[model samples]
Target: MTDFYDRAAAREAEILSDALAAQQRRARNGLGAVSALACEDCGASIPEARRQAIHGVQRCVGCQTVQERLAR
Candidate 1:
């Protein structure tokens, strides 16, 4: 009986963690989508292919790459 309860608790925690991670991802994507289609840092136009590939892409490839590198 104790083992079963522990397993159930572990499963519940796992589910909750997954749900929170997904919610965070959605929020980040939503914020990105709200940004202007043109690159925020540079005036370059965001390509259609990139917009289609990423649900909410705010920057052009070059700007995004630079930002990502700086972030690291």
Candidate 2:
């Protein structure tokens, strides 16, 4: 019983470790870890509504639209 419990705990720890690694490797919006005060591409002030709508938005609507177009 004790061995089974130990194995379960180990499995839980491994799952959490894998999740943390995946999150770290993820590329957050150009803002990095936190939301930016200004657009990363144009230096325009990021609006409160946009920031609230997209937790880590880094670009203003115009800049973001341009970037999306360029990507396409």
Backbone collisions counted per model = 0, 0
1-72: candidate 2 lDDT, tens digit per residue: 579889999999999999988776664433345678999988999988888767778899999999999999
Q: What is the lDDT of residue 65 in candidate 1?
A: 95
lDDT for each residue of candidate 1 in 1-72, tens digit (9 for 90 to 100): 579889999999999999999999887767656445788788898878877777677789999999999999
Candidate 1 lDDT at 53 equals 75
Model 1, position 28, has a per-residue lDDT of 77
In lDDT terms, how accurate is model 2? 0.83
> Would you list the C-alpha lDDT of every candidate in the order shown?
0.83, 0.83
The TM-score values for the models, in the order shown, are 0.54, 0.53
Q: Candidate 2: misplaced stretches above 4 Å?
A: 1-33
